[model samples]
Target: MSKLDPKLAERLRSNADGLFCAVAQQRGTGEVLMVAWMDGEALYRTLTTRKATYYSRSRQSYWVKGETSGNTQYVHEVRLDCDGDTVLLIVDQKGVACHTGTRTCFDTDILLSDSVE
Candidate 1:
């Protein structure tokens, strides 16, 4: 049902729900913004439209980043991992990337780190 190119679709390795990981990072800063999931249709939309489109697992629907919030992610490039299980989206982010209004989703949590020594 996806309108994705057959060749590109064939390379993807999705999970049981037919979704793959999508990581968004700031284009020039190289800062990781957020992580999401995407189906073939979402990927197709992102590629064609240059917008960050993701499949929401809890909502059971698709969402385009910045569609609701004014915080937008204008995608500059997309790269699929060699294993095709994950994708990296380079983007120019406007405003905060986290739903919590932080610049990035990872900003709040710091699990563990080695001593600086």
Candidate 2:
């Protein structure tokens, strides 16, 4: 049912829905672009295609980043956190990373700041 490697699959710790939190970051700049969820199949597709694919909780389906939005994320590397519950994607983003047409999902949110020091 899952195309992910057995060894790799065993290392992952997914939620009840069998999903892992995936964070996308711009390669060189180290800018976090967006956060999404990935199921085993979505991870498999991303690893195989070098494209950022995520499972949409709302849609209850898989979607490739930029499939329709023209904003794409080309994965360069993937890292699993120590807990194995989060995945970090180093990518080359071609366009906006947020659905709102922003460069990143965090751009509009500023709950805290550097001046807090």
Q: Which candidate number would show the highest lDDT if scored against the true structure? A: 1
lDDT of 1 by residue, 1-117 (tens): 899999999999999999999999998899999999999999999999999999999999999999999888999999999999999999999999999989999998898989799
Q: Which stretches of candidate 1 lie over 4 Å from their true place?
A: none
lDDT of 1 at 47: 96
Lowest-scoring 10 consecutive residues by lDDT in candidate 2? 108-117
lDDT of 2: 0.94
Model 2, 35-54: lDDT tens digits are 99998889999999999999
Looking at model 1, residue 73 earns an lDDT score of: 91
Q: What is each predicted model's overall lDDT from 0 to 1?
A: 0.96, 0.94
